[model samples]
Target: MDDDIRRGDLVAEGEPEQEFNPGIAARLPRKTVAGGALVRDEAGRILFLEPTYKPTLDIPGGIAEYDESPYEACVREVQEEIGLALPIGPLLVVDWVPALGVWSDALAFVFDGGILDQPTIDRLVLDPSEARAHYFLTLEEAAPRLRPSMARRLARALQALTTSRPTYTDFGR
Candidate 1:
């Protein structure tokens, strides 16, 4: 992984240049693991959440606490974020986002989850600081709505589910 790190720019004679690189500092291992379900409703729409600060939509999951397991974190996050009770099962994807400088390594475990029969749309609650709104979309509709990285990740996950193939991972795990 250290090989992935590289120098940013060159310094002129007798001049010191400020270094700017994605991997300049030692990358810390992720302490907080998270998971989310790429759920499709009966109407064939995928569930998504619009974050309060971020312009793009995302799956419902966040950082896991030190004592919490990934599955527990998933269940808790879904309930806290959308007021839904879901049973999480199986691991889907474990991704790393090196560009997020602060929390550089994020282990995202996507799962096949159980959905509630009744919709909790009206009763949905949002953490004012975390989310703004929520919506559902079909693959055809969502492709254009997501940011480039999100779109690619979703596409890859969906393709893996469709083809029963394993996904590529940057981390050794």
Candidate 2:
């Protein structure tokens, strides 16, 4: 390691980047971790869900349960919410969301679900308790229907698809 490399209290030329110090870890503030999948249609339109619990539309995803990875959580959510055991691709975006009202700060991720043809789209089974309807729309048409930060992060997710690399998106809102 270079002498310029530094992280937290333990600083040395050859020190590793991550160290397991329980004392320091226990004091770290916890942020909510969420993961979702961005599924597109053959026409390249995004699949959006009208969740019963909220007014605005959302994608297929949810908060990670204890001992669950972000990718696992996203897959579980897709099955639970949309009743599809579809394949989940690589991560596209990770965003930092500020606390609003009663919610704490959060780290959210978006994964690529690849393009779904019409037949597969027709097979989606929505859980009435989670979502009422699903639709496919262009990002421009979907933007106004989502939270500003979400819209921005989603746009970044779409862009990252072309570069084939994960994007870190922060709206700072």
On residues 26-108, what C-alpha lDDT tens digit does candidate 1 reach at each position? 46444446777776566656778888867778877766787666667787788788776766655666665443566555666
lDDT agreement of model 2 with the native: 0.87
Off by over 4 Å in 1: 1-32, 114-124, 163-166, 170-173
Report the lDDT of model 2 for residue 153.
Answer: 85
Each prediction's whole-model lDDT (CA): 0.65, 0.87
lDDT of candidate model 1 versus the reference:
0.65
Query: What TM-score number comes out for model 2?
Result: 0.83
- Candidate 1 is scored at a TM of 0.67
Give the per-residue lDDT of model 2 (tens digit) for 67-143: 66788889899989888898999999999998889999988989998899888888999999999999999988988
TM-score of each: 0.67, 0.83
